[model samples]
Target: MGKLTGFIDYKRENKEERDPAQRIQDWQEYDAPFSDEVLSRQGARCMDCGTPFCQMGEEIHGATSGCPIYNLIPEWNDLVYKGQWKEALNRLMKTNNFPEFTGRVCPAPCEGSCTVAINDPAVTIKSIERTIIDKGFENGWITPRVPKERTGKTVAIIGSGPAGLAAADQLNQAGHTVTVYERDDRAGGLLTYGIPNMKLEKDVVERRIRLLEQEGIDFILNTEVGKDISAEELKHTYDAVLLCTGAQKQRDLVIEGREADGVHFAMDYLKGSTKKLLGSEVDGEQSIDAEGKDVIVIGGGDTGADCIATALRQNCKSIVQFGKHPKLPLVRTEANMWPQYPNVFSIEYAHKEATAKFGEDPRQYSIQTKRFVKDEQGNLKELHTVEMEKVQDENGQMAYREIPGTEKVWPAQLVFIAIGFEGPEQEVLDSFGVETFNQKADAKYGKFETSEANVFAAGDARRGQSLIVWAINEGRELAHKVDEHLMGSTVLPSYLEV
Candidate 1:
């Protein structure tokens, strides 16, 4: 929309990452922002597709097609192309409350569904978004916008993760008093602890929290809802309660010698490293020390990749990642076509660091753990695994079957399980009498409302562990629902219908 023939002349260009060997030595972000001229040219690459599917945010064939939060991509791209930095920031903030966070961590499904991506490189939407927010901060353009009026109603939100933060931001903007409860000493849940510092700096999260405080949202830290304060007490004190606790129940690896001393959950290891980086002291004996030890990371998702990278940063002797599924192809397969999330193989930054330092890709695909072997002192000494074959289940769905004669062993002292989360931890949900629907964390249709009236749930707590974009989507959607229920009507926007 900025220029008629801009897409024909401009090619896509993204920010350059620092060299792997150099970047892994420090816990800092690797990607550098593009200079003003280059970023403007990158924004010029957005095509005038009659129907911009990038904003549709639909899941086709078990894979998402576009931005889950449905950001107004083309509008901001045009504004950026015209050197309208403030305008771009305003447009970006209209739908996304935290472009800085999403710009850094989101997978950017919008780019994959871009029409340009069909035959040419898609526009550098993620980079432009990051640049817009960074500029907003640099120019002192972003400040707290406190509401002009206050509703009599007050909301008590449990959990200070992304979902909880988003809900608080929305309710405060709608002229309601909002208070967020966090179990940790700090405010951000995973953003403060679970994620590695190299990927996202702690200061970035704190800056946003400070802005929220300036806007009048109160935060109560080191307070567990069901434990520190009774659920009945919160129910009586607040006008309505919104449950935004994350899905943190880790799936355990049940096998022989499972009680070995060195075995630990992936979150424990990650949270420990983050706290140490933030100058928080960890408790003695239970702390994980990867220094000079052979590390084996189970599971093959982003968390596992983070574990491999963090181990290497800790100067571990060696690292190996195990995956139960087969390796994905480099290109799209017949089963996973474009407009859907392609099951294509790609190297994450963590894997790249592992290969650079260890002389091999740390991943061992199509392998499943059979058992854990312990040393004489009960410390984990070795891991036994077997290759798996994909077989059809009774319902004709693919399932993993262990191969008969493909068992092998690898040395290890530290094992981190990153298989994924099941649902919200049971104690919090049970405390509120919230029932599960669809065997997952998500609420049933027509009823995100719990058994008790006006009590709502959202995010990973209600929808199971999911993407950051989905968390934002849920927060925005739930805010509208809460608003409608409170006032019998709402002016707040909903992206799903937009």
Candidate 2:
């Protein structure tokens, strides 16, 4: 530890964010980095514990506890505290392929599992991490690490999301000629489009893509593997084919009025907004303009929050987000203990903005959507919802029951369903002829092998939708597995080491 008593001496401080009312007017990132002095003081708050659970990366009771990619938190914290920014960046890059992405979008499960959190406020880990990488870029300390020699073998990776990008970066570094295929006009599957610009700016993604190109990785955009090039052709052309295609199958609200003109899936709405912002051609059917329309978002997750923020940017007349589950407790319950990601209530950026703009939080918990009502013009006009009560079934499992006579209708011209993804899309999986079980690619985690030989799957495609950190873990592991399969030996480091 940099300072043994530093944890006791310092109180936690987070990054400063733009005023909610003012920030909602633009698309820029809301949070601002701390000064080096403040960041150093924050870094010094890392306590000298016998064991640091901040990097454990375990899943207890299905909630992510720590850094899934096993980031060396304590080491980097000490480096930053000692004014060793370059050393901190080096340690950070050793584990995470893209610290900039995780530093911004990651939920920071690492903080939830911080040992210091058991008593006092946890260290400002996320803020310090973002500063370290942002400094690395500002000082030109990070650059292309072009491989000196080629392995004379080629690999083709499908999809260019976090997992695919991570795998491509690792394999390219291992001296193998790697090519990444993306169906979109631009790369970055989730980071570029799935997320709004206010959260993760597109330029940040572009810079990394540019860096990867300088390092000798090829990117082919606007090309779907199955439609443009057959899977068999890809299988024969490359020594190994890896499917890092993400889980993008959106779950729809199957009810009456689902086909209403203004009703849409969250991804479609978000993608349309982002594409329109980027000046990409968007068709009439794809354009889900929320301007001046009363909007209702169904789902109680980060995606729903993003939808709320996006609608606010679009200048919607009114906004409301519905959640099937009740609001979480203010503090951790007995079921959720230390080192387990805290299951508590915290206001997200969207909630704060909504409160600032609209006098209320705009979230309605324990609400179940009954149906969407359509106006005479066949456009979505209203949403009917019923209050729900939590109960335990005969099997002692938790379930929700709708209350009678509690149905209420709210004016809603636009509806976005952000109920999360079921799993990876089936079209790509079918093209590759890989076996699937329960909507996931039938592939082992450590080995990352799919049903077919000379092919592998990882990330959200292999194991349903998850965090970017897990995607990085699987991507790096899959890269190692592919290298082993191709050359029968690999020296690429994976997430196994702490």
Candidate 3:
């Protein structure tokens, strides 16, 4: 370690965020970058623990304990501590292909598993990581690394999200001729659309895509594989095909008045907003304007929070979010101890913005939406909900039961259903003859293979919806699998192999 007693000398410091009240006025990242000296001091706080559980990258109790990509966290922390910025960036890029994306959005399970977090504040791993990469770009250390020779083996990647991008980056480095197919007008699938610009600005995604293009990977946009181009045609044309299409089949609220005009799927609403921000045609229709409308966002996850933040920015009259489950404890409970992802309640950026703008937090836990109430014009007018309590079912399993006579209604001119995702769209799977692992089954990792030869799947498409870090991990692992299939063996590093 560069500083053996640095953890004792330095206190944990996090990156400063822009004032929530001012940041919500526009669609831009709110985090203010840290100076190199401050970032180095933060990196010095990483203790040289014997086990270094921060990079263990294991799943404990169905939740990730550390970085899924197994980033060499301590190594870079040491390099950064010694003011070796270039060395830190090199170590960071060794495990993570896109530090900028993960640094901005990942929930930082790595920090939760940090040794320091057992008794004190954890090292600022995410912010330090962002600084290292951002400095790399600023110093021109990151450049296109075009392969010296092509393997002459062609590969087709279906999807341009994190998984597809990571796979393309790896396969291109391995000297394979890679062509990525995206159904959207732009290359980035979720990064360009599903996530709001306020969280991750569009230019950050585009910069990486441009670098990939310069490195010999070709991108074909607005071209659906199973629709615009047949899967059979791709199978015949390319040597191997990898599916990273992502899990986008939204879980619907199949209650009454689901056909109301102002009710929309979360992705549709998010994509529409992002498209309008980018000056792109949003399905050739105007953006879903939440201005002056009472908004009700269902689901208590990140997507729902994004909806709340977006609505606030759009100058909505009022905002309320509903979560089916009970509120989590403000601190980690005995059941969720160290090294596992702490199931504790913490405010995210969007929630902070909501609180700052609305004078109170907008989340209401243990509430379930019963149905949408619509006006005569068939537009949503209100949302009916009932408070729920946890109770034991007949089988002695925990279940939610509605409190009798606890029904209530809230004015809602627009409703965003952000419940969750079921899995990948079936059309893409059916087209490729792929069989999905039953989600009900007790499998840690889902199936990634299709019935057809040389066809593979990864990320959300195979494993269902998950974090960006997990998606990158899946893409890197899948790339090695595809490479092995083509060359009879592979030299690509597998982070999970640890």
The prediction achieving the highest TM-score against the true structure is 2
| Cα-based TM-score, every candidate | 0.96, 0.98, 0.97
Question: Model 3 TM-score?
Answer: 0.97
- lDDT value, residue 241 of candidate 1: 94
Instruction: Write the number of the candidate with greater lDDT, choosing between 1 and 2.
Output: 2
Q: lDDT, candidate 1, residue 35?
A: 94
Number of the candidate with higher lDDT, 1 or 3: 3
Sort every candidate by lDDT, greatest first.
2, 3, 1
**lDDT of candidates 1 onward, in order:** 0.85, 0.90, 0.88
Evaluate candidate 1 by giving its C-alpha RMSD to the native, one decimal.
Answer: 1.9
Error of 3 at 320 (Å): 0.8
Cα-based RMSD of the predictions, in order?
1.9, 1.5, 1.7
- Give the distance in Å from residue 309's predicted Cα in candidate 2 to where it truly belongs: 0.8
lDDT of 1 by residue, 71-92 (tens): 8899998888889999999999
Native-vs-model 1 lDDT?
0.85
Residue pairs with backbone overlap in model 1: 441-462, 442-462
> Which ranking of candidates, highest TM-score first?
2, 3, 1
